[model samples]
Target chain A: MIRQFGLPEALAILSGVQATILLSLIAFVGGGVVGLAVALMRTSERTWLQRCAGFYIDFFQGTPLLMQLFLVFYGLPVLGYKVNPWIAVAIGFTLHASAFLGEIWRGSIQAVPRGQTEAAYALGLSYASRMRNVVLPQAMRISVAPTVGFMVQLIKGTSLAAIIGFVELSRAAQIIASATYKPLLAYGCAAIVYFVLCFPLSRLSMRLEKRFAVKT
Target chain B: MTYQFDFSVLLPYWEQLLRGCWLTILLSAISISAGLTIGILTALAKRSRFTTARIAAGTYVEIIRNTPFLVQVFFIFFGLPALGISFQPWSAAILALSLNCGAFSAEVIRGGIDAIARGQYEAGTALGLKPLQIFRHIVLKPALRIIFPALSGQFVLTLLTTSIVSSISAEELTSIAQSIDTLTFRSFEIYIVATILYLTMSFGFATLFKLIDRVYFSYPVK
Candidate 1:
């Protein structure tokens, strides 16, 4: 028997939004930390470090995130690293986001004019201080729009966590669809919830792009 | 770190893995061709004079762009069946992938079109060109040329996304890898091979895209 999906059912599925949002938050923050380090390495003067970082970025960027998640979830145990689904997804999404964000941040850092860096050097600013004080601030300004834009992609990327058996929004939608056998209602509700979540960020990204475009 | 890696178990399934790679590439190709056609049409509808056409196209793009492809796949597969319009897993996956990527590529194409200046068309009109010829020569070609890099990036991404189709049990690389993992019980080694296959495909496709760019899109300056 096909059950009718009511407000209660929709609400139950919508409840998965928290898990989705939480997963995105963890991935973004975790990815941001790793991305900064990798971006710095990619932009560093050391050839070996640069090549290693480049390889890391290319490896992550080229492969499917689904595979990456699978590898981390299933493959790690072979190497004797214990991994639950949650930890697996955390590592996977963080790694995936870092690769993309590292590329973005590297471009942003390199975008800062050479004159400014040269001026900092002339002023006796050390490498660390130059980046922390003079360079990163400028790069952060250039990066805000792209970074926020990437946040939208990161949120969408979290949906893949469902494949690893995390009960995030996408997975919860499937569960609801199968449970009720009213997939039209269940998946319809899922799409609506995702739209509500992502549309605003997309618009904000466009607006930020426009604003930044004007400034530069 | 003393774990012994048993990659030898994977050698037996080499044919399956190769076939899976071919299937993955085929899926990406089919989706991208259909998706790009849809994108061009959607981009046109979006810029069309009719308000209804514009809004309808706008809504479709926004809805698809904002939602996750996995949810979109579920909706098209399981949800459509509830309404008595079911598709097999492969067809459903291709439909979802094309629609999802179409929305994105529409934006890319639209951006390219909009970047062209009004004066260029005016200049074409003054040169006694028909509207169609002007659009072909002065607008579409250059717009496509400019968006080639963005299009290439999207191509790589669409190729990666084909792996997501494995969730719906499509007979792609990831699904094959999963089957082999269970049979061989050498999950890490199998996945490592699978990852390398994907990396090779990605690089291979990117080089092909670049070649296509140079051959078809590049124009010599006078």
Candidate 2:
């Protein structure tokens, strides 16, 4: 029996894997920054700000990421904003990733010893200085493991970006699969690529979990 | 920047939006309940005395965990049709959601069971309690308590995952919102409103879970 699928098609598909990686990175960095802000706001003293952040996190975290993508990708254009598909996907994912990451990071932040914050305060460090100099460094140790674990999720999440017309790995797989009528092979290859991308991060997360077990 | 928000466009379509919300809730409730049941079975199977049962369940969890749920839904909705399963969008959505939730729930429940002290099981045997009775009275209670937080967290995740059903043309809240957006040409307002409604639902679940935890656990939450 002759094999119909060739290396060239697989190579072409694999070459486009960078788009998925880019989506994941953009979502990771964008989500990380927004998530940190949300985490801080969640712990803020002001009631309204905390409530707002809490609501934002809850909204993104609660609803389906697919729905969020639909709402952002289709919903925004209807509202007269008329943004590009990439921007919509990025925004949708960033918001979705932010909620989960914010909660995770907040857990890490709260896990920091109260005495550390108290000591920093006693030393007359301003709030920003205390957070930057004394608290975040320690919190990062606690945050690293889970944060790395979440990167796997972000990478997988880029698959949703394809729904909004972004030709990422999953979407590209769909395109080639339909053109070639070998879904099992095409999708299988895509999954393997995703697995290959995510497996290393999973291992890294486990390593971090072991190395930083004390902080957590 | 004189963009005034007009919510009045949504007033005429409130009835449809409400129906969509109803569908969303119904779908979520069904998926979560069914997923929880399947999850328990799978969780137990994964840790069963027989290796084959354990491997079968373990494989189910791993495949579901690793693959994208969107792909799983497609396999059911589109792929199953090729095999003449003939599932409606709702049924397919429920199936996918249940499988996804079951995998996650199995892990949570397994963690709960694993966290149990070995001595506790020995003590049950020493008391002449049968395995079923021991599991029912001792293992089930503490495991539920331990896993409740994670289970609730998974439910929240499931709630969001249900939105993917829209891709199959299921008229859930997001689908309805899309229709409403097309009809009214008020995407920002409708989406903003839908966003708030979703937040309300999330808050509602959180509050309900907290109350249930208080009433059910009563003891200290570990």
**Candidates' RMSD to native:** 1.5, 3.4
Per-residue lDDT tens digits for candidate 2, residues A6-108, read 7876876797698888888888889999999998888777999889988887677766676677678866665678787778888888888888899888888
lDDT of 2 by residue, B32-131 (tens): 9999998989989988899999999987876776667766776666656655687888888889898889888998898888888999999999999999
Candidate 1, A1-216: lDDT as tens digits: 755677777888889899899889988999999999999999999999899889999999899988888788876786788877778788888988888899999999999999999999999999999999999999998998889888888888888888878998888888878777888888889889888999999999889889989987
TM-score of chain A, cand. 1: 0.96
Taking the candidates one at a time, how many backbone clashes does each contain? 0, 2
lDDT (Cα, 0-100) at A33 in candidate 1: 97
Top lDDT prediction, candidate number: 1
Clashing pairs in 2: A63-B160, A64-B160
DockQ of 2: 0.37
The TM-score obtained for chain B of candidate 2 when compared with the true chain B: 0.94
DockQ score of each predicted structure, in the order shown:
0.80, 0.37
Could you give me the TM-score of model 2 versus the true structure? Answer: 0.88
Candidate 1 chain A has its poorest 10 consecutive residues by lDDT at: A1-10
lDDT of model 2, residue B66? 65
